[model samples]
Target: MGEPSVDNMFSTASNKPHSRRKRMLSNVYSKSHIMANEALKAQISTIIYDRFLPYLASTFDDTPPTTTTEQPQTQPGGGGVFNICALLSATTMDIVTGYIFGLNASSNLIDNREELAWFLDLYNSRRSFNFWPQEFPRFTAFVERWMPGYRLSPKWVDEANGEIEKWTADMCERADAQVSSAGAVGGEEKAECVPVVYQQLWKALSKEAKGEEESGGTLSQQLRMSLASEVLDHLAAGFDTSGITLTYIVHELSQHPDIQSRLQKELLTLSPRLVPSSAPAAIPDPKAVDALPVLHAVIWETLRLHSAIPGPQPRFTPAQGCRLGPEEKSYYVPGGVRVSASAGLLHLNEEVYERASEWRPERWLDMDRLDVEKKKDMESRWFWAFGSGGRMCIGSHLAVYQMKYIVAALYSNYSTTIVDDTDIEQSDAYTAPPKSDKLMIKLIKAYT
Candidate 1:
């Protein structure tokens, strides 16, 4: 309710503080580090092989298995239509929390359908209420404290925050326990048992943190709250953003069978294709996955068309005055001015991107034909899915890893048919998902 303390790296104002916070865990978020992280690898393997694939193999999970009322012929599988949107959300939450608190202690939302449903229900409900408290906290607080019965958000909003905060606190405590008992033998623990980010942040804060008054809590207490604040944001973005992107990727690929087939072929080229049986113990080389041109194109094209955070990323102009716009007609603007740019608008620029509104992965693949400047403009300058500069999404590499792996696993083993995509168009919001918030798909298992 109070807006998790601004100490989280993304919301912090000054560059100095933000950089310091980032330095605490930047190394591990690097692609090299994520690929090599034993915990992540083990957890991902379990999620795909043990959890996800089995769930899909069930063909369909028709609740009640029978109904007197007529049901839509969403899929022929007969089990029932699956809400891929909810599944993707659950998958992301599991993976991100696993990375944060270690898989042993992280959520089993992927396996617990009921809990997964509950979590998403609570989480998505609050998205609409974030406007007041997030953008104008002081005003929101004033209304609540003075204007009796006049609240910007409902009571359930605070209740949802409390539930999520409690969940995060439990994970933080588990991470603390693991760190306290860690020793040489800790390395022998299960690969996914190591809480990497939590351990790093606690160690850094323990050494540097000196006073209780700064955050109105003792050193260890303050550190725990800070850890909760930071990781919660990371967990939210790490899952939601990637989940949205992957959902759109699946939706698009299903609509374009040829493109989906081509991407699957590309995924299969890896030494260990994500097929569960063929390579039970075979995890594809991260480098190989990263190198797949078609896979890259699909992801990039989806990001271009459906950026999760399609809204503006606001930035304050520097303290020193600077020119505002076009060099020829630019006028000086004072510092601290709120300036913003929209990834959604940039990606739709027709001059920079031919047939800008179309979902053409070829645009990325065909970039070699363009001159360097044009290529840069099309690919780098306009693309802002993860924002830019020091404040960019820190877990971006991990998000990419999870999305790519999940996609590879899915298409490698099954062909998806879009069952019902009514209201699939994205909502007009910062972290936009389909306004309908559901994507029914039929999973046709594939084999050689």
Candidate 2:
């Protein structure tokens, strides 16, 4: 979105720069690192128990409604009817920011509806104005210079971006300050509150600057922009995609009570369990939660059927022209041409996935029941939720980590039924959210 030097890992085009940035934070985002991080575990516990569950509880009456087979068409008086899409967006924002900036310095949007509404309005406002700048940058730049009286996108888009950038910069400063204070005070108790992502990136950048200075090179002036831009991209994408996926997870589970019941049984199998009274004292081990097959199946199915970033991820052809299509019908394509592949299309290949349009978590569960080659193709070749290869999503592990725990903690205590799903279809966009941006559902306490 800015200068190449200040852009995030995803925006950095050259392999060298992108690989350099990725190396700085790759260790922390690794599946092993995320699963074992005590800081992350503490952050998840605080967000899920202290913030998320309490907020859900506040939505219902003092006494939880008794479980029943008959689903209600509607309910009134704080009847646990909540716009789940909005709630999920807020929940994921808190979780993602907590890991980025530490639980002590993060936005607790789950506890404040007004702040959540304001932030979402500011964020989603920019989606409509992305076409010209993203698709046709040259034309947008030409128009801006030649047609001074007219504007392709409104002025407020700039204001919105400024506000977001300012907010990110503030978080960076807060994190830096926390690190300094931690060192000065010999902070021991707050070990679990470390701003893992920010600290790793800042230290890595500083180290590079120090090495450059020793070699008689000038110090970089854009360090602040680099750090802020990278983390802002992380925060935005992390929260949005996971939130959208989780919303659909809840929607699908609600639609299928049989599936919901089965998921709850699996969640309850954890030792400490994520039930209300047990939390704050203990949260299930993330590894244990991750091992649950039913939970894994449900999450995987939702990700496939309702992928968050379902649109084309564009890439440029290499300078040395390349061949395209199957070897039998290969054709030459000239260098520098833009090419794109879509996950939505790939996942819908009937050969790869039978009855591909349906949401069947059983397919994942039945992988062993299929032939060897068929199973391999589905898992490694066709399933492209977080993409593949070196430039694939770096935060994929963290996203799945938070989602599984969040879902486990949620279904452990309550069961949800759809209250209103009008226009619940996913929007057709690069990063899709629900079209109406709302999915109302009612939560009932699960008492066994």
Candidate 3:
């Protein structure tokens, strides 16, 4: 046995000329692929200086609102007062979908109990069947379609996939229709539709469909399906990461009222933006909320401590054993062995962090004071909140932006006091979420 070829497995096939159209199609739906790569650089410039900072400054108000505390104790055999896991899942879905589709799809578990339950049920069902179809593709495919007692039958998986695909396609269709209608309505009467990646993707696919080469297959079906999967990946990754980060941030803030107060004070500076207003203008600019130091540090610390996807990011070792780490020492990792590292373990290294296990945002502030060599070690070897190299999270920046906004919005406008504190530990999985399903917190409105 030899190391599996690391060709298309890791690389984005969108680079080739033949596949350029497909790449373009992907860009239409993939913010990571299109907007982040080309548009974000320029678009960020417009928002970063002009709109972002001002929005952050507006979140703070003169007088903060007082919240009433009601702590819920675990009833012997009854369910815990707060299900942190479920809360996290709802938060993730809202933030991710909100960013990608410009829809406030988050069930806001704090308010809508029934919707939260429905969402968590669907989410768990999908999670239980994920690895089988993704990892052992051939076997799972065979068993699903033909074999009996396949716990998650092929029928169920297909139904789930179909439902998801239909949802995505509907979004894509609506976006496309809006774009076309806007184009038809000449002059300045055009309205900007929601910022969905699907709009761009449909445009690219349409172009490819019209200019199909003699031997090439139809772009309408294959391209659409491929892009659909890519969108699903973004939805799954975006929601899961942001949700986990939010849950941890809430947990930590609940435990440390002083830090929470400091954060609220910072948020208060944002004034009208912090005030809950129905107008779109009232919503703080995304870029500005992203730049708050305390907010950034809180999110960073949460990501470092409870990395959502912290398992082994395995890569098949090269046939000619390659040198890894700063030492450049060659280690013969057998060709087929899954060589990888874990952010969960790496983030806890004492060499990089003084109180490695402790949650301390101050450490990030003083990182510059450390010795150059020490700082280099931290940057190179220890920090891996996002996986390294090409496969690194494409949505890292987006995730950060969304998490900061959610935290800022919550803490700036209201105070969060934990209703229940017991069993706050996280589950051990690819998306290591809180073990408990509820996170009951009293939200006291802040007064301007």
Model 3, runs deviating above 4 Å = 1-92, 102-116, 145-162, 183-192, 205-219, 277-280, 285-287, 319-321, 325-329, 334-336
How well does each candidate superpose onto the true structure, as a TM-score?
A: 0.91, 0.92, 0.73
| Alpha-carbon runs more than 4 Å astray in model 2 | 1-5, 61-78, 182-189, 212-221
Residue pairs clashing, model 1: 62-79
Worst 10 residues of 2 by lDDT: 65-74
Among all windows of 10 consecutive residues in model 1, the one with the lowest summed lDDT is 65-74
Give per-residue CA lDDT, model 2, range 367-387, as digits (tens).
Answer: 789999999888878888899
lDDT of 2: 0.82
What are the C-alpha RMSDs, in order, of all predicted structures?
A: 3.8, 4.7, 8.3
Q: Arrange candidates by lDDT, highest first: which order?
A: 2, 1, 3
Backbone atom clashes (below 3 Å) for every candidate:
1, 0, 25
- Note the Cα lDDT for every prediction shown: 0.80, 0.82, 0.56
- Residue 140: error of model 2 in Å? 2.7
Instruction: Name the weakest run of 10 consecutive residues (lDDT summed) in model 3.
Output: 1-10
